[model samples]
Target chain A: MNIAVLGAGNIAWHLSKALIHAGHPVKQIWNRTSEKAVALALEIGADSISTLNQIDTDIDLIIIAVSDEAIESVAKDLQLLPHQLLVHTSGSTALDVLLTYTQKAGVIYPLQTFSKAVQVDFSQIPIGIEAFDEGSTQALFNLAKTLSTKTYYINSQQRLVLHAAAVFACNFTNHFYSIAQELIQQSGLDFNLIRPLIQETAAKVQQVLPQEAQTGPAKRNDQLTIQKHLDLLKTNPAWKLLYEQISQDIVKMYSKDTSSLK
Target chain B: MNIAVLGAGNIAWHLSKALIHAGHPVKQIWNRTSEKAVALALEIGADSISTLNQIDTDIDLIIIAVSDEAIESVAKDLQLLPHQLLVHTSGSTALDVLLTYTQKAGVIYPLQTFSKAVQVDFSQIPIGIEAFDEGSTQALFNLAKTLSTKTYYINSQQRLVLHAAAVFACNFTNHFYSIAQELIQQSGLDFNLIRPLIQETAAKVQQVLPQEAQTGPAKRNDQLTIQKHLDLLKTNPAWKLLYEQISQDIVKMYSKDTSSLK
Candidate 1:
């Protein structure tokens, strides 16, 4: 299948490479910055376009792999035939945003973090697909299958929740590591000491439920150790509050007392 | 060197197994429950003692791998010769706690979560050692070197900070996964969809700093997406509050202006 990628960012770079490697021909690549677009196009053997209007109407699929805010504007600027499918690769953006510009619209959101430096294994990364109609859905699903082994037909509402959950699981978790790094650095200790613990925690969740895998002073309701940690964080009021709040939440979860409503 | 394990808990099981595997002789295994002690002792070809008085004075090293609250009592109960070294496998406990029980006291705290069900490779596990004197410190260091490749001479204050950091990086991070799992389960979406995302997020930290690796609506400061997620979380006040707090913290971190304090 012939496809046109509409971005020059990390996601676009990785997605275009994966699609090309999967035997799909990328016909055109467009970005607001022509340098990045030209570089990506040359790498993927695709035509470099400076504007959305330069995209050919003959392409079978047009994947708008731009930022969430740019999806609608990019869709409005595109000049495509009604038969050509247009989809935005965003987890938060609603499908209706694409329908405003084209009748044949869909979403093929890859539910994983992408980095230009990192080579992602698309085979395990989940691709969530949603389309305006049954035929377009099948086409997007078929295309997604070529790039990933795990594909799901997710609606807009479910995708929103998935994105939120990803924020907590991925984004928030990374922030926790940052906090850990700060704590160790302040104590004049190497942050690399905690690397194995971080990896092991993630690995444990793969086989066991996170609830069951939970351990530490909070889970054990050891107030003494908790108080010690809180006192240690006295210099940083923000961190102290965060530690107190999360510890309270964990204590509540394990206490089996739902008197205090969540 | 002759070693006696003072508990049959998860840490004791793993530590004893690793010590034995490293060619160090486990002279005895003792626990309040004789059955568990016997099971672990038989597995590692060591004597199982039901009472603390049964501990042989001939042992070179005594490792008290009990709960934080029981460490002092276990140390008080141990009957060791003057030259024999004593240690507790605790991160938060100070080196002085062990010195109260024996002149030759040290610590061999492993900075990783352990489980009886999961087998761990000690090569990557960081062993934090602290002792009352230089000679005991060297002796404990030699013992730790046998079980782990990563050994550090961390003082009591540093170990306290390290333990606190582990809570943020491992324990609190796992709680975030629990929150994500809860959210996805409520939405009737497979939690497995986010598993790859979780793994990738952890993997990113191995190469890049967590501060630089952070991504999501929070990091992007996309208030619209944040508000939408907040609206979806209205029914669950506990989660809603958590979501708001963490998102606010992330936004504060990325926003150059320090006017907004969380």
Candidate 2:
């Protein structure tokens, strides 16, 4: 299927490249800045369109892989082909927002955080897709299948929930690393020392349920160590708040189980 | 070298199994509980000793792979040869703590989290070692080198600092997952949806530094989305605190560069 990408951000740049590599023709590429669109198109040997009005209605799909706030406006500007499927690559935005403009509207969200500097292996990334009509849904499903082994026909509600989970799993988790880096720097240790532990912790969850895999002061209910960590974080409000919130949640999780065992 | 293991916890169990697999001579294994000691020894096909008095002082090393609080007590109980190396597999405890009891003292900390159910590949894990004397240090380093491809000559101060970082990287990061799991549960989404995101976030760090590879609303400083996420966590005070703290940190980190550019 020929695909037209409607943005020039990280997700768009990576996804367009992956599609081209997977033997799909990118019909057209467009960005608010025409140069970005031209650069990406030239790299992938696809046509570049400077304006949404220039987007061909004959294309199979128009993927608006822009920021959450930018998607609605882009959709409003694009004159959709009578039967062309329109989609966005946002995790938080609802599908109904696209449905209002086109009967052949859907979502083609790739469930991985992407960056242009680091190439993503789309074959391993899960793709969440939804469409208002069966024909459009099947097209999106097949398109996802070509690029990945896992594809889900998730609805708008589930997509938003998945998006929220993505925030915790990816965004919030990165914040934890940043905080860890900050704390380790303050403690006068090389960040390299914790690299193995970080890699192993993430690797462990592949084989174990996260709840069963938890190990630490909070998991052990060791209030002494918890207090020590909190004391260490006192000077930095970010670390202090994070330490408290996670500790409290851990306490609540364990307390529920502790009472049941009694 | 004849080795004696003085604990039956996660680290002790895994390290002992690796030693036995590598054809090292484990003289005996001891634990507070006779059953745990017997079980561990049997698992590695070594003898189990219920009393520290029964340990062979002629052994080359006696590793106190116990909890931080129990290390001193265990070290006090062990009677060893004058030249025998005494070490503890702890990141927080100082080597001096063991040096006070034995002339030959050192540390042999494997920088990975271990679980009894999972068989860890020691060859891939990094081992941190330190000793009081050059001879003892070389001996421990040789022993560590035999078990793992990666080894570090880390001092007491470095070990403690590394341990604190491990808490932030592994312990606190897992708490982030717990928070995500809770959010997904509330939103009525399958917790598994976030697994790919979690895995990719960690995998990306291997290719680039954390500072250079950060993303999300917080990193981008997109106030609109940050406001949305904070609002989502408003009901959960603990999560709210964490959200605000991390957001502030992100703001502070980016503000520096943003201001410089202005």
Candidate 3:
């Protein structure tokens, strides 16, 4: 299949390589910065286009792997033939956003964090596909299947929820790690001490429900230990509040008490 | 080394098995519940003592692996020889608590979440050792080295901070998974969708600083998507507040403005 990748960011760099490795040739690559576009295109053996007008109309699929805010603007610049499919790789933007540019619109959101420095196994990552019509859906699904074994047909609304859940699962989880790092650093202990615990905590969730995997003072409702931890955070009022509120939330969750602490 | 394991809880169950695997002969096993003690003792080929008075004076070390609240009471019950070492497996409790019972007292706190259902590789788990003197410290260090490759001489104050950090890295991180599960379930999507993301988030922390690993709307400061998520969570006021506060905190963190939001 002939494909053209939009943007030269982390996702684009990874996606282009995965697509080319999956036997789909990326015909053209474009980015706001011509240098990045040229570099990525050279790396992927694709033509570097300085402007959207130079995008190959003969391409079978065009994937806009740009940021959420840039999706609509990128979509507006596309000039696709009736046979070509256009899709944006975003979890938050609705299908209608792409519909404004062309009737043959779809989504191919890769449900994993990507970094230029990190090489991820595309086969293990889940790819979410959404389209306005059956034909585009099938094409996107087949395209996604080439890059990943785990593919789901998620609609815009479900994708939105998944994105939000990712914030809690990925973003918030990483924030907790940052908080742990800060606390450990302040205490003059190596942060590496908690690495095993972090890995096991995540591994436990794979086999059991997060509620079942839950352990610690909050889940056990050990008020004395909780109080001690809160006391330790007295110098940092924001951390103290966060620790108290999250602890209270966990206690409330396990105790099945609906009483609002606020 | 001759060792006695006190408490047949999850930690004790795993610790005792690991000790036996490391060629340390467990002299006795005791729990408040005789049945559990007997069960564990029989499994590990050790004698089960029904009373604290039955604790063998010939044992080289006695490890109290009970709850934090019961540690002091358990210490008070132990009939140890002057030459024997005593240690409690607790992170938050101060060394002075054990000092009240015996000058030979120390800590052998294992800094990993344990479960009876899941078998963990003890070699990967970090064991924090703290004692009143060099002899006991070296003794505990040698004992810990048998069960785990990762061992540290963390003082009581450092251990307390590590305990608080564990709350953030393990306990609070699990709570975030729970929150993500609840949100996804409410949206009529399978919670499994976020499992891969959770695993990757934890894996990323092993290589990079958590602050460097941070991603998503909060880190990007994408207010539009943030507002959309906040709107979606409006029905659950607690979750809405959590989403708002954490998002604000992430923005504050990367923005480098030290002004507290609260």
Q: What is the DockQ of each candidate?
A: 0.76, 0.57, 0.77
lDDT of each: 0.89, 0.81, 0.89
DockQ winner: 3
Candidate 3: list runs displaced more than 4 Å: A257-262, B257-262
Q: Per-model i-RMS in Å?
A: 1.0, 1.9, 0.9
Residues B1-262 of candidate 3 have per-residue lDDT tens digits of 6999999999999999999999999989999999999999999999999899998768889999998999999999877788989898998999999888799989999999988888899999999999998999988988899889999989998998899999989998899999999878877888777888889989998898898888888888999999989888898888888888888889989887335432
Q: What ranking emerges by TM-score with the best candidate at the front?
A: 3, 1, 2
> Against the true structure, what is model 3's DockQ?
0.77
- lDDT per residue (tens digit) for residues B102-167 in model 2: 879999999888889877788988888999999999999899889999888888877766666677
Quality of candidate 2 docking, DockQ: 0.57
lDDT of 2 at B182: 74
Assess the local accuracy of residue B31 in candidate 2 as a C-alpha lDDT between 0 and 100.
95
* Candidate 2 ranges beyond 4 A from true positions: A183-189, A231-235, B185-188, B260-262
Q: After superposition, how far is residue B134 of candidate 3 from its true place, in Å?
A: 1.4
Retained native contacts per candidate, as fractions? 0.78, 0.58, 0.74
